[model samples]
Structure formats: C-alpha cells, structure tokens
Target: MADQQDELRALLKDSGEPTLERAIAKAREMVDRLDNVTLNIAVTGETGAGKSKFVNAIRGLQDTDEGAAPTGVTETTMEPTMYLHPTMPNVNFWDLPGIGTPKFKAETYMKDVKYQNYDFFIIVSAGRFKENDMILAKEIKKKKKNFYFVRTKTDLDVTQEAKKGETEEQTLQKIRKDCVENVRTLGSPSVFLITSENLARFDFQELVNNLERDLPDNKKYALVMSLPVYSKESLEKKYNTFKKAAWAVAFASGGIAAAPVPGLSTACDVAMVVPFLIKCYYSFGLDDGSLEKLSKRVNKPILEEVKKSSLVSAIADKSSLATKIAAKLAVAGVVESVCSLMPGAGSIAAAGISFVTTRSVLLEGVKELHRVAEKVIEMAELK
Candidate 1:
C-alpha cells in the first residue's frame, strides 16, 4: 500500500504542485489546455509561392487531401482563408492573400488580413526574397510577433541545378546563401528551404524545432501533438510527451473524490480515461483514416499491420470513435473488460482506485498506441 502511494506521487510529479488537491487542479488545467489550446499560424507569400501546399503539409495532409487549401499558379487566396488541422481543430492555418499584387503595400496587406489573429507568420518565396517580402517582414516584426522566411520548390531547384554540373550540396548552399543575403535586412533571420511534397526531407524538422522553441509552453505541446509522426525519433518524442502527462491523467480521473463507475472493479471516473485514450489514438495516428492515408501515401498495407495488436484492433474496428467508444456506456464496457483481468480490481472503491492501477492502464494504452505507430513507421519506411 505504501509502495502504491509512492508510485502515485511519482506519477503526479509533472504537475509540480505539492498537495494532491493542488496537483489535481493543475492536472485538470493541463489536460484541458492540451485538449483545447488554439494555435493559429499565418501562411502568407506571393502568388504561387506554395503557401497552400505548405499549409497542407504542416497539417499532415497532401494537396489532394480533403479540406486542403487549393494550390495553383494563380492567386488562390484572395482573403484570409482558414484551414484547420485535420486532427486538431483548434490549431488553424490561415492562408493569407499574396502580398505581391501590382499595388502591393505591407500596411494595407496586414490590415486586410486582420493580422492580430495569428500566432506567427511564415513568409514564403519561390525564388528571391523581393522588396515586397521585406516590407511585409518588417511590418510583422513591428507588431512584435515571430516571423519566418521559407523558400519553396527546393526539390525542383535541386533537380534543375543538378543538370548544370552542380551537386545537391552546392545547389542547396547556393540557394541558402542567396536567400540569406536577401533577408539580411531582417537581422539575418534564418531561412528554411523545403519541398511540401516531402516534409521529412530538407529543413522541415528544423523549422518545427524553431517554432516549438519560440511558442509558449502550452502552445508548444499543441504544436508537437498536432504534427504527423514521420519518423522513429518523432514517434518517441510524442510518446515521451504523453508519458509525462500520464500521472496528471491518472490523478484527474481516479484521484480524490471521483464518482464511482459501474462494471469496474474500481470506482474511478471512466469519462476522463476514455477521452484520454482517444486523444492518444489521434496523436499516435492509429485511427483508420490516418492509417489509410499513410498506407496510400507509402503504398503499403500499414493499416492491416497495425490491426495486429488487440488494443489497437479494438479501437480500429470502430468506424467512429466518438460514437462507438466515447459514449459513457461504451467506456463503461471498456472499464469492465479491462478491470476484470486485474487481481484486486473487484474490491477497489472510487477513492481507492489506486494510483498504480490508473497509471498502469494509462501506460498500457499509451504503449500500445506507440507500438502500433512505430510499426507503421517501420512498414511504411518513413524517415
């Protein structure tokens, strides 16, 4: 029993609060923020600078994915068009109008787009950073918000340059040098070169790192959780983030005065546990739609491979998680099924739903999702 208390305390350490009540309060706040924080990113540039593709790529979608911003050689964004992240609704990408029209003016462009709504701005350019791009960058800086410069269609550049007897490294260096020289007026701000068709290549991860470093703590988690799990390293990062939050989840659901849940050996609240697992499901990209998309992208049978795990199969079998498992009745059924296997589960009370038990269940769920996600990454040969 004493060991159980120690385990619970260790789990709650991430909350940084002294007492159980305070820790629970902080845990609730953290969980709520994780579930609902809003991150609005503004993707703006000249016409045909690949803003729409960048928006789609960052949101873990292809240009052909449903709800993706349309891309074309002509100006597609006549106004500030909002594109919500497919899995994370609160995190939005605002595709703003091109700043390179004939009568282009930075102040007017900023006002036209209602620039106050975005967390940051990404200025993309296909070739050279022009006078208009510099003007807009200064305006965004004056407003005291972070801004990044991106050079798009880098794959085409590399392919074209290779024909001119230049190696890929030389081409990349030449491009970066030219871009840096152009943006020198902006205090030598770093420029990211990327191809939206394949984000795992080039400087996409570096860009994500910079953004995560600059964002506030809560927003950082939102940004990280919303990114596609593209590599083993990325999967591990997501797992660690979820693992760190497990204690908060356990305490928030089973600690203190939680209501008794029927059919469970223990009387802890089932509502929190259900949603937390669902969040894991989405974050780990275990849903059928996510897996299907991955399968199609990699031309592999990843979805079938992920279903090999019983826990993953349980969630994957359902067409709609909200309808099939998020319901109270459905979650209670899960509780009954999961708890029946535990030795002391039948005798546990609401307040006596030991921290060890809650933590164990959460770890099990997170690990299972992590396992399936790793398998998909391996089978798909994702970087």
Candidate 2:
C-alpha cells in the first residue's frame, strides 16, 4: 500500500497531472495508443516480380503457409489485397496490383490502390528496375510518401552465377551495381537485395533498419513487434521494444483492480498481463510453431530445449484456450511469488497491488523470454 502511494505520487509529479486519478487515466490512454497503432504497408511491382513472396516472407510466413499472399509467374494480385500479420493484426501488408499492366498504368496505380491509406510503399523487382517502376516511384514521391526499391531472387542469381565461376560476393556486388544503375534516374535510391527463402542473409535486416529510421514511433513499434525473429539482432530488437513498453503495460494492468480472472489470486489484471506475455511469446519466436520451424530449419531438437522454461511451457501447452488458461495461472503464480519476496508486499490486498510489483513481473517475464529466444538463436546459429 505504501509503495503504491509513493509510486502514484511520483507518477502524478512526473506527469504533471495534479491528481492521482488524472495520472492513472493519462497512463491508460498512453497504453491504449500503443495497443491500437496501425501500419498499412503498400507493396507494388511489375508482374512476376516476386512481390507476393516478399510479402509473405516479411510477415514471417512461407509461400504456402495459410493466409500467405498468392504467388505465381503471372500476376496474382489484381487488386490491393491486405494480409494481416498473424500476431499483430493492426500491422497490415497490402499487396497492390502489378504495375505497368495494360489495365493498371504506373501513373494511375497509386490512385487506383488508394495510396493515401498506406504508410509507405515498397517497389519490388526480380531483375533490373523498369520504366514503370521509376514512374511509380516518382508518383509516390510527388505525393510526399516514402518508397523503397527491393531486388529479389538474389539466391537464384548467386547459384546461377556460381556455375559461371563467379564468387558470391562478386555476384551480389554485380547485382547491386546493376540495380543502382537502373534506378539511378531516381537519384540512386538504395535497393535492398533479398531472397524470400532466407531473410537472415543479404540486406533484409538493413531494410528493416531503414524502415525503423523512417517510420513514426507507433508504427515503428508495430513493425518491430510484427516481424519474425530471424537473428539475434532481430530478437534483441523485440526484447528492447517489449522492455520499453513494460512500464505502460504494468501501469494500465495494475492501476485499477479489474474483475478477477479465472485463476488469478492477485489484484493485477491477469487478462492484460496474459495477452502482453503471449504477444512476447509469439514475437520472440518462442511459440511452438515458431520453434518447430526453427528446429526443422537447423536440424536440431530446439522445441524441447525451449519448452524447458516453465513460463514458455505453460503458455505453449495444448490448444489456444488451454494455453491462455495455463498462462494466466502461471502469471498469477509469478505475481504471488514476487509479492512474497518483496518486503511488505504480503500485506497488500487484491485491490492494492502496487505498480512496482506488476512492473517487476512484466520485466522479469520479458527478460526470461528474451534469454530463451537468444538461446534459440544461438543454437540455430542464425547470423
């Protein structure tokens, strides 16, 4: 109780709310904004440019995975198709129609796709950039929006060039030089060389870094959380994002006592905490599906190794509902255990859980998940 009062006083002072109620209300509003931020990405390219495959890869899905954007030699996206991120629904990828087609002219492509709705655009091409791509890039620029050029199929290019006695580095440099020369008319914008087969290789992470620099804070958070943990760096990005948001989540969940959840014995809202932790579970690639995929990719028994963590095991066991119930119990147990260890925390009632206590649980949970994710990355040897 004393801890709660002191924390509330600090919040009120820092927030300049003049009252505890106002401070808590402002904190909830901040949390709400973080939870609801949306990002709509527009991907445009010529037909057979591998745009659909790139879309699926960015969303952490294989080409044949359920809900992946359709891909083929011919145009598969005739209209703007929105594919929601499997975990972060607010982050959407819009696969726009292929440019330079008779039906969809490059000049009119942005208008046809309602370009105003998207945050930015990515112009993808399997080979050299086309005139239509340049035209579309200019159009997007004229509209005061950002667009990036992506050259795909670098893996195939590398393999084919290897048969010609060219080194991998030579082939990559040649491709990059060709792409830059082709788009030199657009002031030589950086063209990301990528392969949907393996995002950890080549310049996918660099593309992400550029996006992180360009996007607004809310949208950046959504993008970071939505992307797959392909490497240790990507996992660390997720860990930092979650760590930064922990205070807001804790305040929102513990500021007021909500209705008791099924298994929670504490005042902290297990409902809020469960979803946040589960998001971390998926974002950090600790879920069963993610682990299974990694395990198969690395030809190792990673799932079993990761499931050794009780928190992970609890969140990943059985069906989704069962998992949620188990996660709630596990989180409640953590809260109880944490409270027992904190001096004077045992005297606090269900309605009086301090923000400090909730913050500790959330940070600790995120830290543990991060450690497990880092181990997975190390075991898989993902660069």
Per the 3 Å backbone cut-off, how many clashing residue pairs does candidate 2 have? 0
Report the C-alpha lDDT of model 2 over 118-166, residue by residue, as the tens digit: 9999999899888888898999999999999998989999999999999
For each candidate in turn, the TM-score is: 0.87, 0.85
TM-score of 1: 0.87
Which prediction has the highest TM-score against the true structure? 1
Maximum-lDDT candidate = 2
List pairs with backbone clashes in candidate 2: none
lDDT of 1 at 145: 87
- Which ten-residue region of model 2 has the weakest summed lDDT? 343-352
Give the total clashing residue pairs for model 1: 0
Model 1, span 207-258: residue lDDT tens: 8889989998778888888888777777887898788777667776644324
RMSD each, Å = 4.2, 3.9
